[model samples]
Target: MGVALRDIIADCKETLDLDALKGVAAIDAHNALYQFLSIIRQPDGTPLMNAEGQVTSHLTGILFRTANFVEKGIKPVYIFDGTPPTFKQETLDQRREVRTRAGNAWKEALAVGDIAEAYKQASASARVDAYVIETAQELLGLLGIPWVQAPSEGEAQAAHMAGKGSVQFAVSQDYDSLLFGSPVLVRNLTVSGRRRVRGRTITVSPERIVLANLLDYLGVSREELIEIALLTGTDYHPGVRGVGAKTALKLVRNGEFESTVAEKLPDFDPASIREFFLAPPVTDDYNLSWSAPDTDGVVAMLSGRFDFSPERVEGALEKLSVKAKQQTLDQWF
Candidate 1:
């Protein structure tokens, strides 16, 4: 449940390209992998698998997409989530239930030969298993792409990096990063293509949201923004029974948030959740560096273990190498 600020926020612009990023990006790794698993499925709703029957969509997504980023002079630092806050357990359990239902729905739709419905449900049912995560880590390591394991949510860590000026932007499809104080957030970095709406599919571009611009335009402080999010709902808590984005904003603006929350969520502690968003767990025990791809390591996993074409693996790595060299040369100058 990302912050539902889309209805109220107007500082977003969808005119960004890879070349515009020309700086470091802190990516929400788990989010990106989940997107890959959801979108890279075949027409019949089956994921691409290796000879041993393991999913390879995540690997393929990371390889080609990250290479494109690198080739365009954008340095990406993938951030993986660690432990989750106890408050988010409910949200995770609900997601599991949705996935289970989606899985059944996907099978039923497929059985009935409803191809479109099957594809939609299959996308909803996609899960990033341990194998996918581990293989992705191995591949990122082999490609010499720097990654950080967050103490909690990857979005928090990515936001921290951006806020601290360690990266150019905090990259994710969620608007929650704004609550985490990321100076800038980029959405659709991975899925920058056509998106389906109610009935028609429309081509979409990458968009950027600036924290300062949003706050200034909304006439609310960052702290107040958190209050609005708490009132509307978040992954950690199920906001007030009847509150919504518009009403939440009104309450925040009128300084009635505390009174409203007290009446609606008498037994719940909204302050703590707000504080958690204001400052989530993050770490600084990682370095941001782009080195030559570990050719042997990449070969071992993609070719030896996963049976990916050796030529394809080498070709992708070669692109990374060329960009790494170009980055180094630019730095020297």
Candidate 2:
């Protein structure tokens, strides 16, 4: 999970139509995969699986969602996380525990025929395992979508690419991309559409956040914004108890971040976290070339191997073909 800075940074977000987002975007692959695993499921929250009991929800998501991106003139380059920072081990362990509990809760809810509760619990139980990652990369190749293996955090690598102008922006639902100094961050790109929330159907649209505008609106430097995130907790460190985003912002603005950390979290060093965000581990050794989708390969994998409907797969490929023909490879970059 990313830092909870949405509450304070809401004003800096700009709602955008799909037509306006025509450019190269570095997508956080794991984040998008998690969204797929969570959202693309049966009524009872059972994920789509093939004959061998392998999960196909992510494949469906990659095929259709990436097609939609291409149809909308967006070139997406996926970035996968390699190794996480050592400081993030606790967070990883905590996430595993949460998923385990949620998985048990999902089974219990399904046993009791509580579809809604099962769905909720199943979403929380979504996991991105090695099999999921490997298959996702395979399908992406068939779709002619490039993917990079980041040396560390995927979001940080995406931010690094965006900062270097290798891509127009970083696409992720998490606000941590901003903390990582991505000049621009696009949210809700993967799951944007009509969504149900609390029994009410709502439309979710893509929103863009520019780092400079956010800093200007908050009247604090990027460093201060990161400090705000630290006070409200991050994946690396549990923040001070009872400090929310607004309170953290105030504390940072009033120049009390160091003093407050000293008083509340005397043993923790904020500098380490700060340094990680400021200069996270990243690599420049990656290719970002878009090419024609391997139609037969895609069909063979999705339909022949997996149990996806051949007709639906063909339709999705048609979308990719129509858009790919309209824009050349040079136009994408």
Candidate 3:
């Protein structure tokens, strides 16, 4: 999970039409793949799988969603996460426990004919395994979409690309990108459409968060913001008990951050966490390049290998080709 700063940062977000977004974006590949595996499932909680029982939901998502991005004039560069920091082991372990519980719950729900609960728990149990990553990378390569392997967290690398002006923004569903120093962060890019929540259907649109505007609005420095997250919670550390986003914000603004941390979290020091977010490991060795998709290769992999419908594969390729032609014509003028 990301840092729990949404409550304090809600006012900083702005909704935008898909047409308004254009330029290169650094996408968190793991985050997006998880979304795909979670949301692109059948009503019975089963993922889209091939004859050999291989999941294809992620492949379908990357192919169609990347085409949709190209249609909207957005060039995406996916960033895959590397080895996580040692401090995050606790969080990873907790996630594993949660997934195990959810998986058992999903099976129980299905056995009891509770489709809704099964679907919900299956969504929570979604995991991005090595097979998913390898297949996703292969599909991206066939589609001619560039990907970067980060030295640490994918969000940090995406933030670095955005901060360095290599990309217009970072795309993730987590607020941690802001903590990672991404100048601009776009959320809901992968799942931006009609979605069912609770018992109602609602429209989900892409939203943008600008770091400078957020800092100016909050009247706090970026370091202070990280302090707020530390008091609340983050992937690296469990925050102070009973501290929330608003409470943490108040503590930081009142200049009582140190006093509160010392009183509540006597055994924990936040300095290392602060330094990690501020100066996280990142690499500049990646090349961002977009090229025409390998049409025969894409068809062969998706249709022949994975058993996707040839017609749908061609339809997605057609969208990519049309967008490419439009861009070419616009440039020639």
Candidate 4:
């Protein structure tokens, strides 16, 4: 569970374009790859796979998607997750259980010819396995995309990068980055597609979330915001029973947080969680640079090793190289 601040927090959104970004975006790698795995599935619920039965949906997303951004002058710095904090183990277990259930549901739906339900469950069951991640990293490397291995959560690391002025924004779909104190968060950076929401398809655009504006609108300190998130449940901990965003906001506003937490969450130590968010483990040992894709390396990895269509790969790379050269010429002139 990410922070349920969506309902209560006011967002400072702007329609994003490639020209508006001032610096590189620190992308949460797993978040993006998982999204790719979740969406690039066939109608029959099977993922895009190569001849060797390796999933290539993540690769397809990375290649074409990053190429699109690069052509339009938006630079991305992909950040990968490291060892998770122990507190998140339970949440990870819960997610695994959910994926298992979704897998079974997908099979059942496929058996019954419920194609829509099968697709939905298949998307829900999508996982970023070791091979998928390793391949993604390798592809990013060959493409000359900068990627960092974070000390912990990728979002946290991205947030840290933004805070340190290393990047302009942290890119993710979750609100936890705000708690990590990222000044900016960009959501829906990957696509402009229709989503099935409550049985209807809805179009979505990229939205920005500015931390300072949100805090000022709510008239709460960053710590108070964290308190509200704790009350509203997060990936690291289950919130108190019967508490939600509204009630949590009220508690924070009324300065009754300690009392209410003591009464309803006797075993919970909010401070520790607060500390975890405030100073999540991250690193500054990485370089931030964008370069032309290593064409030979990219072709060897995707076509020779993964069996992706060499023509398609070359076409996308050709466009990327052309645009990159144009941008370089424009910069110099």
lDDT of 2 by residue, 253-308 (tens): 99999999999999999888899999999999988988778999998999899978
Model 3, 177-246: lDDT tens digits are: 8988999999887435787888698998898999999999999999999999999999999898889999
TM-score of each: 0.94, 0.97, 0.97, 0.94
Candidate 2, residue 83: the lDDT equals 90
Where does the lowest 10-residue lDDT sum fall in candidate 1? 324-333
Report the candidate with higher TM-score, 1 versus 3. Answer: 3
Q: Itemize residue pairs with steric clashes in candidate 3.
A: none
Model 4 lDDT per residue over 215-298, tens place:
888899999999999988999898877888888999999998899889988988888788999899989899887777899999
Off by over 4 Å in 3: 190-192, 329-333
Ordered list by lDDT, greatest first: 2, 3, 4, 1
Question: Distance (Å) between predicted and true CA of 99, model 1?
Answer: 0.5
lDDT of 1 by residue, 16-114 (tens): 765677788999888899989998888768888988798999999999888888887778889988999999999999999999999999999999998
CA RMSD of all predictions: 2.1, 1.2, 1.8, 2.2
Best by TM-score: 2
The alpha-carbon lDDT assigned to residue 56 of candidate 4 equals: 91
CA shift of 222, model 4, Å? 0.9
Q: How much RMSD separates candidate 3 from the native structure?
A: 1.8
* Per-model lDDT: 0.85, 0.92, 0.91, 0.86
